[model samples]
Target chain A: MLGLSITQWLFGTLSLMAIMFALMMVFTRSPVNSALYLIMTFFCIAGHYLLLNAQFLAVVQIVVYAGAIMVLFLYIIMLMNLNADEEPRKHVLTRAIAAIIGGMLLFVMIGALRGAEQLQIVQGGASQIGLVKNLGKVLFTEFLFPFEIASVLLLAALVGAIMIGKRDTNINTK
Target chain B: MLNGIPINYYIMLSAVLFIIGAVGVMARRNAIIIFMCIELMLNAVNLMLVAFSTLHNDANGQVFVFFIMAVAAAEVAVGLAILSMVYRNFKSIDIDLLSRLKN
Candidate 1:
């Protein structure tokens, strides 16, 4: 008589898809395919955000992550003209160590999580903090300083990107 | 029997994602793939933050996620530029081949 609700079903499906896509991103031979898989993972994460009622964050995740960042990655991948089998084979030892380290990190984190107290379902009435209007209000008012700083940071990043990416024929000639 | 799912599931899922990202970063030779793995790790953290924010009935976590997204965007721009430059110079983007600085 028990069945998963719409929220549960969505969460389960999205999380599974996210995990699968992430793994594929790691294991796929082609960088372009990996970039595409990353985009899929990002979309799944955005769905998770929506389930949590962080609609604004979800939209931004899609716009910034799936939209802007991923396009940049794909563009770079294309520009480089990378082939599927181009990467030199990693040493077996390196692969083993990486897997072991990853497993240990997961083990430790899960162990720590096991000791935490059981969390009760949040009883707060339908939260509206996720709405763009309310989030914009708080972002501008309470978090105004950080907001300005973020803009400055973006500008700096833009300048830095331009500097790094600009052609320098002198270096090649020398 | 899934009525109200426990918060632990989300935490566990995030942890799994983080681990996958870590492994990808370590195992991948291409710098761009490493960068994508890093992005994956960041997304895992963002998911955890949002889940906690919902649990605590606060919007601050969402705000922080916003900031994180901005930073991530900036990082991707600069990082990919650098990666492309490295590719241009070495004719490959493999991280192992980036040891010319040691010479």
Candidate 2:
């Protein structure tokens, strides 16, 4: 039962942290504060990855989501200098409806899950396939084409962002 | 004790996180905040993927998580650039003010 308690503790704490921060991200008035909370949520998720024995993914999650993507979010927020002052207040009815819809979706998903066969959670001690060596082999060998394609997709996104963001002086003359 | 936690717990956690994200997306008017909510949804999906990967004892799901991360990064780059452009033109990032298409 020691193993069960430890698993429950870790999963419980991580999920609680993740859920709270995600809620804070959504409910917070300031976009900057929302971004900060989202970053914390990412860290909590990365901790879950670590618990699952996916060390490489945990590290990548931090670097890409927390480090790179969040930096971009913050940079945009800073650039725009957004604040709650400009926000149009949402109606109480609209918020209530949204809450009802979201709650319903959660209920449906959980209900569907109730019939599923209980999965025996893998213990923490065993080395699983999430190791870098195993994942790298699979990524480069079986998933090689998709891997290259992802780079291309990233390049396209980079170019598209640059084009869209560039100032067009000709619009006034046109 | 550590290994004995049922997988349903993780799934429930994912569902809760996803619901929060979905609610945020529907309720928030600020475009940037909505975008952050979308990220939360993506992270919830990632958590589910990793949990399943552990269940199946396969690395494929982990690899998929890597792709998802790359795609998310690209998406943020382009999406944020678009948001900045919208702010430049409208002087506001509120979704309601972006109703020029509502002819």
Candidate 3:
């Protein structure tokens, strides 16, 4: 058993699955397949959120990321009819450089966090802070301004998307 | 304490995920795929934020994650719209072919 509890086991499994799916998402040639793999990765992340007891965020992660965003991705892919064979591969040298860059970044990050385990995290015992009631209270009070701004941002994005996606009738007339 | 798991574990996991996303962004030529990679990077950041939030027992970090999700949604909407328009004009979504602006 290696002295590991069930929670540790779950964490290990979820992390591995998440990494594997993310790799598959990047490596897959088909856009649809890539999207699907990314969805699986999102689910794994949601599981991580639940493990952390961020229940509201866990549900939101699934609803927003896995549900809305990925659906939009699939819709765009289907609309464009992008096929696996049609996508032109990047040069081999470019891919190798990218991999090397990523590896270096990972190495630097790990190096920076060499003593992170010794850093003490103050544990507020059995905190109910992850619940929606607590989060909403904080959100509406201290963060009220940002919350209102986010709404305006969403509105602007909606209008901009419509403007961009609509066919320009004036071009044909000219 | 998240079942006695160290915060470093979450940190490492997110770091790896973020690196994967960064590599995907740099290596892929497809604009849509690049956009997805950006989303992946954002998710990695979100995970880190939530983990820290839990560590400190503060709802503020989770609130930031919520705001991030909002911004990400808006960004995706506008980005995909632009990408679709680009496809309409160029008949392709390959970033290499869209190099007319470089000249």
> Which candidate should be chosen as best, given TM-score against the real structure?
3
Candidate 1 lDDT over residue span B1-103, tens digit each: 2244578988999999999999999998989999999999999999999888888878898999999999998888889889888887889888988887899
Clashing pairs in 3: none
Per-residue lDDT of model 2, residues B1-103, tens digit only = 3546678988998899999999998998999988998988998899999988888888889999999999998898899889988988988888888988897
True interface contacts retained by model 1? 0.73
- Judged by lDDT, which candidate is best? 3
Model 2 lDDT per residue over A1-174, tens place: 454466678888888899999989988888788899999999999999988889999999999999999998998998988776666557889999999999899889988998999877666857468888899999999999999999999999999999989987899569
Using lDDT as the measure, name the better of candidate 2 and candidate 3: 3
Q: In model 3, state the lDDT of residue A57.
A: 95
Worst lDDT run of 10 residues, candidate 1 chain A, spans A118-127
Single out the weakest 10-residue window by summed lDDT for candidate 1 chain B. Answer: B1-10
**What is the C-alpha DockQ of each candidate?**
0.66, 0.80, 0.66
Candidate 3: tens digits of C-alpha lDDT, residues A1-174: 898777788889999999999999999999999999999999999999888878899999999999999999999999999999999789999999999999999999999999665533333346688888899899999999999999999999999999999999999799
Misplaced by over 4 Å in model 2 are A1-4
